[model samples]
Target: MKSTVEHLSPTRVRINVEVPFDELKPDFDRAYKKIAQQVRIPGFRPGKAPARILEARIGRAPVLDEVVNAAIPAKYQEAVVASDDVTPIGRPEIEVTEIADHERLTFTAEVDVRPEFELPELEGLTVEVDETEIGEDEVTEQLDQLRARFGTLAGVERAAQKGDYVQIDLSAAVDGTAIEEATTTGFSYEVGQGGLIDGIDEALEGMSADEEKTFTSTLVAGEYADREAEVTVKVTTVKERHLPDADDEFAQLASEFDTLDELTESLRERIGQSKRMEQAGQARDRLLEKLVEGTEVPLPESVVQAEVDSRAHDAVHAFDHDEDKFAEFLATQDKTREQFDAETREEAEKNVRYRLVLDALADREEISVGDQELTERILFQAQQYGMAPEQFVQQIQQAGQLGVIYQDVRRSKALIQAVRAATVTLPGGEVVDLSDLLGDDDADETVEEVPGEVVAESAEDVDGDAADDADTAEDKADAKA
Candidate 1:
């Protein structure tokens, strides 16, 4: 067998392959066995007919097609691996150019390969992120919410206010188009929860029982229409919060803390930790956005397609091939499968651009993943997946997904290095504290987000990589961790 590659472009190649008569023998024999099983010959058992006899019955073209089709993928894969080029993401379009049943086989496949790009700028670019300092008021507010969680609900004799829980039968119409028909009977929604329909919560803020009011509000756009809907909300009941007594006994009942003061102190610590984490999130997002903007690079089609395939594969895998999630996802959006596919492709394109930009920065600055850092990051991520570290490491090695792993490590290290080189400023014009951007207290919540499909290790997902490592030695460390 001989294979020669013709360069179509930096990211495209046409590999002209020639399989000689000797190499075609194995495939010819195998193809006969496969075809023999599918058809019956007179005076012969199925799959037991001689190759020559079956070929005489079926003619040579059909048998040759079977052999070529069956053997092309394996042959192409070998040729691809042997080539001195970067990896290919999507499957190739295979076509048989020439073939002879016992002579030679030839074909071509047009594939999408990773693009070539120069490193982008990633120096002292700046971004403004919200602060992490937990003011006394913020601490108190968190403490109050915690206290309220343990408190009992009670009926209020007064008018409904902001902090009250109301049970109401709500209905709405849009030029006689009823959309708010969705029932929430005995629905327990927190009044100030902004996640509910916009402006609907404010309408019930001060209303009393049995009071009905018709107000027009626009539906949240995008999936929901932007048109206005006139809603008639009737407040059936309004109940106020009855907080627990902020005393020693109550504190003991609510937590392991001995006294109300101890509980408050613990809450303060937790709240501070939470605030630090929140700021860390903002800091990370700001940093990523800045990194993307700082660098200017064009993304390749493979990069985007690779991400799209990854997402689709994960979604199907997560459902264990149930297929209902795919249907439901599209149905909810009032879209078909084609539209969803396009959306995935678009998302993949953004992901590719972001990844390329970050990588260019890493390369330009000579930043790289250390061996020790890689091992630790892998082990930590394995634990997150609830697997043993050794097992996870073995799996990563087996699947050849280590390139993806190394890229993640390089990006993270590069970002951290940039942070060290940068000078940050806060909104009040004071020099912002850079501490929160690097580390936070809730080490567990810092699970990483890798595009919309893969999750890598970061502050949010510090242990995410461990999840990928699900094998034996890995499982042991994972169990211990």
Candidate 2:
């Protein structure tokens, strides 16, 4: 195979490849033989047909096509690997020209190439991270939430009131047209949570058992495009919260802690974990912002158009059949569909560039996600999505999206290395702490800090109130379904 590379731009290339008749003859012979073994000539034994006869029986074009299809992929892969350019993530536009028994097989493939650029000095890269602090009120508030989680629902003797949970039968319509999707049976809602079909809460503010009420609400056509549905609500049961006593016994029953003191410390640790996650997210965003600022490449119109169409197609499908909110969304942003495509095209280019950078950075730093890291990352994602880790793994495999998950793991590893490899400088002259960004299984390294006057023990004494309350409320609310 003979190939010639043409640089269209720093970020694009055209590789024209030709298989001389001499090179293609062997492939043609193998393909012919393979076809001969399966075909029976009228007077010949199976697998004994000659190439000329087989070519005659099946036309030169069909045999040439088979040879070309089997040959292009291997040759394209070799040509890509042989060049300094990074192979594209998407398809290459391939056009075949020459196809004959004794003639060369000529084809041209246009592909996007990773832009060659200098790495901006990224050492000592720093950004201001909000100081980690556990305040007394925050700790107390957290404890109260935990207590709410442990709270039990008690039967109410009075009519349904605001903040009360009520079992309800619901029905809704649009312009007096009754719709089945607008109805539910035995739905329980906590007044003021803002989840119900509009105006249901206001109508149910003071209603006894089986009291019917009707209200009007403008459906925002947000996620559900049933516009301005008139809904009827009926209150069936009124229930009030009966919280557990916040004593040592309560602490002991709710958690591993036997005392309020232990429970408070645990809550503080949980809060710290949450704060660490936020800080890590901010750091990653900052790194991305910087990377975008430093990279330069000429993006092809085709790549951007493809990405925008893909994004728009997905957005349009999210709504009811033939109905799309993206048009409105684009309008709100002051962009025409064409303008939106142009903007998203730039975003697509950035994503492609970032991916290329990740590939290069990973190779240069030898960054890798090991089996343990993959397992932990998958489990962490499952936990984040409120899915069982093993089940989530199976689901990803079943859906054939595991490659997406693997790429996520690889990206995480690459992000860490890229940040560590760069020079970070804080705008406020204070260094950001990246201790939270390091993997848990990584060797322990003492972070630079004077222990910061020691975290106030008084603040850490707050109970696990907040988390408990959220869990409790979610449990009660979801149980009604």
The ten-residue window of minimal lDDT in model 1 covers 457-466
Stretches of candidate 1 exceeding 4 Å from the true structure: 116-131, 170-199, 213-232, 245-250, 259-261, 278-298, 302-349, 357-447, 451-481
Cand. 2 Cα-lDDT: 0.64
Question: For candidate 2, lDDT tens digit of each residue in 1-481?
Answer: 7778898877678888887778766677778878888888988788788888987887777777778876665566555555554444334667777775676778876765445666555564554455567787777889888888988888787888887999999887777777676679898899878875667777888898789987777665543364777778888898998878877999988888899988998889888877766665556656756765676645545555555676667766765425446677667778787886676676666665565555445455555556776677678778889999889999977654554555555655666655555544345565655654554434321121111111101000111222222222222221221
Best by TM-score: 2
Error of 2 at 422 (Å): 5.4
**Model 2 reaches what TM-score against the true structure?**
0.78
Summarize candidate 1's per-residue lDDT along 231-275 as a digit string, tens digits: 777787888788877789888888898898898888888876776
Deviating ranges (above 4 Å) for candidate 2: 33-40, 45-48, 175-177, 218-225, 300-302, 320-339, 371-406, 421-428, 440-481
